[model samples]
Target: MATTTASVMGPHQKYAFEDTTSLLKDINRLPLFMTELDPTDGEGGSNLALEALQALAYEGTPFEIASNFKQQGNDCFSLKHFKDAAEYYGRAIAAILQNDKKKEETSGENSTDKAELAETDEHGSPLQIIDNCGPNADDDEAEKLKELVTTCYLNRAACNLELKNHRRVINDCAEVLKVQPRNAKAYYRSARACLAIDKIKEAQECVERGLDLEPQNSYFKNLAIKIMQREDYLLKVQQQNTQREFMRKHVVRI
Candidate 1:
């Protein structure tokens, strides 16, 4: 009601939000599905697929991330992501105070810093857990801490990847593999980073590991193909260069 009311009142300047989970829950019928597809199929301007995905995609909500911090040692724990509204609110408080604490600590300046303590994210949960639920975390508290730590590594690894930090991405992938050896995505992501960094052997190993984990996966197979092509191309180029250099140095007089 509030959302509809806000839109009607705001009219030309209206902005509104909807809960994607709830919306998906209500659309279980085929007739309704056609109606839903109609908006998405509109060929012109922004359509339903883009808009719906934006609503459901992982958003960078800082407070929600911070509130779920974890230590590297704990096993049993809880990680409940706050509602979007609440998380946004928490983010506001987190950002400002986070800077202050950093400067204070840097200059050896001490201040009333409870927010700093909470905000000093060692490892973030959103980055680690495949789902909110953990396997060992369900019964053991100690494992939860490690999971949280694992998540932090993931978040940083992602940030690094965004900055084109492939080496660090590899490092993060390694960290994840240490904890979750069967993480196919991590292996795949690591292989991608390795390829970017010109680490062909490492990339091959990672991709092969991923393929071993999921032999029937089309995506993984595609990734392996890409790697093989790249490595083969590099080898070919190197051989060509070597042959060219040798021929130039040992050319016989006509």
Candidate 2:
């Protein structure tokens, strides 16, 4: 029996000779898909293609979306667009928080009472049970997201500082400190904002904490000096007021 091979079509044979030029023309029109096409024009496609592309660019996992927004915030900050940068950082924070809520809900659903009754030793004392369950995959992911959220808060604080939103800067830095108590930048920023608003005590506390974390940091050192100077000035003003009050109260009648 004789076997015959199947004839495969080559590139040139795939289309009719005259139709090849028309196909090339269609290929050349591909760029037009991205542009907003006029509805009255002969083109059948709408701007949906462009919209879809834009949506696709934004679609990602929560961490990825947060990271993208963070990068956008960094770009805006570099350009000194502090207000826009803060907005982007806020978006990043919202994205991460949304993911955290979802994770919490899922964990609630899958959680069980894994705790057991404690066992007693030979002497009737409760035995010390050390949990060897080290950090799991979920723990690792949570830690990463926490770090990202802290970074977003810190960046937003920086933007707020440039915008002179002292309270907002303090709040953002407080959020960072809550998550990362040893964060020197958060303490520094918070101290700066408190000092800006004349919250001398608060500023002094933040400066002390930051200095404890970074004793050699020039920024913290300088801020500490400023806080001390402000405190002394306020103390002098209070004393002067007190003296004036005493003199007014003891003034002889004319």
Candidate 3:
């Protein structure tokens, strides 16, 4: 399937049409269904396109509005709005990834966290952390923030998946679980990473934990079944390989 790769430049440039033609070209690297998407004056999409969408989003565009609300809701996780912080973090990472966010990282992993930040938490210090989603809030804004923690992690995990950083994805899922232990998506991601690294037993364990946390989650249930099947298949393969090797080595010199 075609994927949305990050621009060599930043999201600001990307959103500002600094290289519209190239962006469009990259967008069209493979076949797409943008047939229904129209550009103003038939000029094709540009920074104007993004701004227009942002404007519509602000002006009651249901989907955009929902996203905005969700973002706002993401702000309620902590009394300090850790979810909002995570969204900002996601945006920052995306920006640096696209080159729009340019804060220096604590250690420059992706220039995510600035070299100097005074942010401290329950852990007694600040760390370059990201999350998938957060808990629920009674207020609208807080609810939005609470809902984003799990999703934010899933979104970031996707980026890691694209980069083939399966191990990092596993760690990201771990962070997701810290916020909400019942996060099925996080477990799915961790299992996927385990499978990628040939840790079938580990993947099975993660899936099982996920299912136990949410017995009704179809995703987790399906994943658990799939992991068991894979584990069995892997075992069969190893056994077959062993038998073949033994046969070859021990066959009488006939």
Error of 1 at 149 (Å): 2.3
- 2 or 3: which has the higher TM-score? 2
lDDT (0 to 1) per candidate? 0.52, 0.67, 0.53
lDDT of the structure predicted as candidate 1: 0.52
- Higher-scoring candidate on lDDT, 1 or 3: 3
TM-score of 1: 0.48
Q: Evaluated with TM-score, which candidate comes out highest?
A: 2
Residue 25: error of model 3 in Å? 10
Q: What TM-score goes with each of the models?
A: 0.48, 0.63, 0.47
| Candidate 2 local lDDT, 1-254, one digit each (tens) | 99999998766653456476555644444435412223321256544544454345346766787788889799889989898778777776665444422244233221011001111122111111111112343656666677776788789899989899999888777666765789999999999999999999899999898888888999989888888998999899999999999999999979
Over 106-196, each residue of candidate 3 has an lDDT whose tens digit, in order, gives 3324222321121223321111222212233235543444344346556556556655678768866776677678777788888888977
> lDDT winner among the candidates?
2
Residue-wise C-alpha lDDT for candidate 1, range 86-122, written one tens digit per residue: 2232233232224321233244422223223323345
Off by over 4 Å in 3: 1-150, 162-164
Lowest summed lDDT window (length 10), candidate 3: 124-133
